[model samples]
Target: MWRDPGAPADSFYEIRPECTDVPKSRFRIKAGKTLSARKWHAAFSPEGYLDIGKTLSRIHRGGIHPSIRGEVWEFLLGCYDPKSTFEERDEIRQRRRTQYAEWKEECRQLFPLVGSGRFITAPVVTEDGQPIQDPLVLLENNPDGGAIVPPQTPQDNNGMGPPSTDAANKLEKMTDKGVIQWMLTLHQIGLDVIRTDRTLVFYEKKENLSKLWDILAVYARIDTDVGYCQGMSDLCSPMIILLNDEADAFWCFERLMRRLRGNFRCTDSSVGVEAQLSNLASITQVIDPKLHQHLEHLGGGDYLFAFRMLMVLFRREFSFCDSLYLWEMMWALEYDPDMFWLYEDAEETSDKSEEAKARLKSIRHYGKYERENMKNASKSSEEPPLPISVFLVASVLKEKSATLLQQARGLDDVVKILNDVNGNLDAKKACVAALKLHKKYLKKAKKP
Candidate 1:
């Protein structure tokens, strides 16, 4: 029932990236010996540089060396151009740090109570320098006493009526209202942060927990439209742990959110998760009609059960390390080779430098399908890149088709089956299956 933008309302199928066997890496980074800082620097030179596409492909082919993850991820997340020299990137890094600090400062000013971890009962001084009692605290302490008394307004030295004007009172009321809303969101963020990655030892420290809270709070302040959402804490926890730098983690998380922000929108007009669920339904119907029919029979044609999976990109469904690996691989596949050329000036090298040349060539050459689509491009250009997560979800459902068709009598049964998969999925196997299914879907989509 869901339609891709610009597609006919009746059409249920759309093309997505095809699945292919990912090549195994020859230069796998190991624990102690990662892609060194020196080697990373050498990748960029004046005449010719390392083929970023090839380098990232190689990283995806094998896992990133543990030691180099922070540096490599900065490149992967678009924090720096792969071709940028060390000096260029260092300048960019400093500027970004300053920007992040400014945003954090704005957040602090907007929500001082939450940022400073002050109790709600803390006295608020008025413009006249008079301390006002917190009404809620007063109520709590004197529940059995007579009616509560409001704080007395400050009088002038003449001991006449309070000097506070109506305008001042109005401004104070507005500030109090804003603080209340901020406190509510801050409370929810704290709750989610505490539960985010408790299984990991890093979150055991209270300071680490506070860091998670700060990033999410500031993000909420920065993007008031999306504001704070529940599952965001889960997405941010791993970044904080992996990057170890608060600003860097925030920027990485921000880059990720650009792709995922739609999922968190709760407005009536927002497509968000509903559109994705529709994509999953359409994929299932085309690839495995029987399984699709079974789900439809169970009153799950909407496929809402997979909501959590899409929301946090399967963070809960896989182990910590596996989730990170899956994310890196997905990013690699999603990498737009054109992005490098758009951001950097290509330099020619001698024929002897075959490797760099090959990478540059690959960047220039579009896939056959992509070229054909571009010739007839329409509103499709406006669509965001198809996230690999949808196909990944489809792969999981296909694997469980038999069980679902035979055992699932209702929606609850379907939820139980998918829930059982948590912590049991093999990251590599899922990626392969997802790619294969994507390939199959694209082939079918291309046919008359």
Candidate 2:
């Protein structure tokens, strides 16, 4: 039940790399050069052959310029690989658009309302692949232009003379029970969509709202298991606002969902927020046993309160713009320069330098070890190049530990305290704190 406070405030948070001694106010991109679209394109070019690690490091040290936020975000979100040529990415983009359109068409076929009144009757096919006639077309061709009368219901048999045209009209308005039950999520999705980013003028338009609904509805149909969740609208609103093309925005959101799908799974057998909450608790117990004991005493040892923050990656905790900044920085730090080439075929061993060969051998060994020990590992996936959102939750709790221990006597106090931090968090400080705690946890975990 987290609530977003309209638009983000004008304040900016300055984040610096873990080792940087530069003052927060003075933080800028690497070497003080701005990361414009031209510079980004050059760095990602095949001819330039710039190291992606170096480029991302520059972006991490100095944020991308405002003019190129949209373009740069696609790279960070894994929509395109650094090694892919512009032409290659364009082809991929077109393919993705086609795929998204097919999903939308599927939605329209299953739920006729999604057609936005563009089509009166949805096309259907019989089991043998025969096309069904359009009912609306038949109505349009009728000379009388009269309503299609429906058969009398049992209630109409009450010795009340032959049913009137009004009764037939009401009866003819059929309810697609199957479709209604299948799409029961429409109501919840609509509610959340309207509430999402309410402060933005873009969301006020009916067409924009419908576009959001269409994307969510189609996605729900595509991934029936996960379907539509409450917080998904919050995650998607930013993408809709930033990306112009609906297809492109849907693809970007899809990629993001791949990384975050674990958070939304609510089934008993699924490793979802409960698993992450356990990790957060373990981290807390080790780092600050006193606070952990206090929380335990207050019946919050489960750490359920951190659910919303981790579920949406702090979208409700920070302002909209700050959330974007935090996500970009997190993605940059998590970017693995070798990820692209890891699964691809390598050249002949003789052609590689000894140093290069050794690096490749090490990477292969690490991958093998990771795959073998993944079950026992605390992280659900391979260890990220940087810490994930769980650490940020730990950081926030640690930052407010003093206040909680001093004044919080029960669970309600803790909830109130966290609610107050909704839109007032400093992203840079939270990140720095999280990084420090991450190092500490790593050192502790390595102890025999």
Task: Name the best candidate (by lDDT).
Answer: 1
Candidate 2 local lDDT, 63-130, one digit each (tens): 66544666777766767655556676688789889989898887766645563622111122223333
What root-mean-square deviation over C-alphas does model 1 reach? 14.0
Candidate 1 per-residue C-alpha lDDT over 98-137 given as tens digits, one digit per residue, 9 for 90 to 100: 9888987876665453344222222234434333433234
TM-score of each: 0.72, 0.70
Model 1: residues with Cα > 4 Å off, grouped in runs: 1-50, 113-172, 175-183, 269-271, 337-361, 364-385
Poorest 10 consecutive residues of model 1 by lDDT? 154-163
Please report the candidate that would top TM-score against the real structure: 1
lDDT of 2: 0.62
